[model samples]
Target: MIRAITGLLSGIVFGFGLALSGMMNPARVRGFLDLFGQWDPTLAFVMGGAILAMALAWLFQAQTDKPACASQYHLPDTKHIDGRLIGGAALFGIGWGLGGLCPGPGIASLATQFVPALIFVASMLLGMTFFRLWNRG
Candidate 1:
């Protein structure tokens, strides 16, 4: 129950931050990605802020033996980079470049930019489903 509540609250805060930072805006993201053209530096500040926050979070996590809501902290164990990682990253970059929205901002934009967000999210889900099915061997 506590874990679920924490997850929900974290998601809400994240969505709110995305909306507040103009990350929910596809044009803004695309503008930020546009290097040769009219590039926007707003998302750079947002990224920097996020990195700083996560750095603080890491510091806090280092001090804790376990999570407040759980008995243990769940962390990624993988350090090896393989084809899957590279392929997924390339695909994600392509999708983000073309659509101007990644998963977080894409999900957040569902409230404000419903139609486009819906399309993006639906496509993302479909892609995910296809990947799962294809890899289910």
Candidate 2:
């Protein structure tokens, strides 16, 4: 119950932040990616702030034995990057560049009932389903 509540609250905060930062707008995201053109640096500040916050959280986590709501900290174990990781990252970058909406902002944008965001999210889900089926084969 505590975990669920905390997760919900955190997601609410994150979504609110995304909306407030203009990240929920696909045009703003595309503008940020338009380097050498009319590039916007606002997203960079948002990214930097997120990175700083995560770094601080990591530092704090290292000092604790367990999370307040969980018994153990679930961190990624993979240290070495392989071809699959690189390829997936490339795909993600290509998708973001083309659509101007990654998963987080895309989902957040759904609150406005934007058709493009709905289509993007549907395509994302389809891609995930395809990946799952491919991996099982």
TM-score of 1: 0.95
**Maximum-TM-score candidate:** 2
TM-score of each: 0.95, 0.96
**Which digits, one per residue and each the tens of the lDDT, describe model 1 over residues 3-74?**
899999999999999988998888888999889999999999999999999999999999999989989999
What C-alpha lDDT, on a 0 to 100 scale, does residue 55 get in candidate 1? Answer: 100
Measure candidate 1: CA RMSD: 1.1
The backbone clash count of each candidate, in order, is 0, 0
Q: Tell me the deviation in Å of residue 31 in model 2.
A: 0.8
In the range 14-131, model 2's lDDT, one tens digit per residue, is: 9999999998887887899889999999899999999999999999999999999989999999799999999999999999988988999999889885798899999999999999
